[model samples]
Target: MMEAININHFNRHKITEADIIRRILSGEKELYEILVRRNNQKLYRVIRSYLNDEAEIEDIMQNSYIKGFTKLYQFKLEASFSTWLIRIAINEALARLKEKGKLYHISERAEELNKNTILEIPDKKQLNPQDKMIHHEAKQLLEKAIDQLEPKYKIVYMMKEIEGMSLKETALALDLTLSNVKVRLHRSKEMLKDSLFVISHDTHIFEFGFSRCDRITERVMENI
Candidate 1:
């Protein structure tokens, strides 16, 4: 039923990094679709954690791929292609957040970490509908709660909770002291928990974009 190439019937058994590079350099621009399809879900989860707008998610993702392709020639054998691409994606997603006024308190979170600030969240159903209505609602509530956080906490939440980046990676990315990242992450999670439990009807901020993007992923997969 797939409208595209039968990936299962590819003449080649695997797509290695060298193969991808060769294809790119040989002027096979459309071949990049293989890479895009392979990485879409991974990239989506990365974007979803920090952003709620599905269309904007597509915009940012498309932007990331463009940036990655342009920078492909600069890639080295030091890191896997996917790792390098993910770094590019994360940077793009963060930049998108900044442009949308989601990033705030740009300096305070860089302060030394204290015992007072840390982010924590209880287990909650994510995109799964059957997980529990209250918990599903909690996820939406959490997004709204995040919009209210100071830039410091927001960045930490975006990096840790959404992107699942290790603390070391996050610390390096934000140029923050390790403790600072941890503390802010803790505070952000706590705030989100409190917000999600309150049951908000004004959840318009994340409703539309997320659903649409989710649909896009489904369509792409079903067709491929």
Candidate 2:
């Protein structure tokens, strides 16, 4: 199929992020689509970690992408593009929070007051319709619990656990020390009920699906 051939062609000549940036800077503006498609899910997760409103999240994502494109010249090739982009998205989220007077201090000591707990859900590969419904409900419960966590822990959880970023990458993106990243991740797990951790790995949570992905990609491409 054409899709398979395209996939093969892409794999055979995969471009590095830095290379894409270089080409984009050199006037191959269309290459920016590659970056937008690649990082859409990540940007969504990071922004969602701060604000729950879907419309607002998409607005901030658009602003972040436009800002990133305008400031692309300042981006250093030595650094991770995703990390740099995430920092911008985080800043945008924080600014929105500040505007709404919702910005709050993040204190490690405050997290210490919460007791550790764990919740488990059944995991089965082949499920009847009833079992599938139960699984869906369980995942929803886990998502709600994650949503209730303090912003400090929630962002770490989103990046490290949901997004599957390395501890170092998470630290770099968040501008936290490695130990701080580890501590926050550990604390996030504790607060989430360790047993529910299985669901994160097995199922998609906080998904940014294909339709939305295409919309963001098209919009960013249009503006940039």
Best by TM-score: 2
Clash pairs (backbone) in predicted model 1: 54-209, 104-151, 118-186, 118-187, 119-185, 119-186, 119-187
Report clash pairs, candidate 2.
118-193
TM-score of each: 0.54, 0.88
lDDT of 1 by residue, 1-224 (tens): 22245533432578676777777767765555566666665566556555657777776777777777777788775655655776787788778778878654243433333435333433443535555565555555456556656656666676566555688767765668899888887777665544343333233323435455445544443333
Every candidate's CA RMSD: 7.9, 3.7
Question: Any idea what lDDT model 2 has?
Answer: 0.82
Best by lDDT: 2
Least lDDT summed over 10 consecutive residues: which range in candidate 1?
A: 197-206
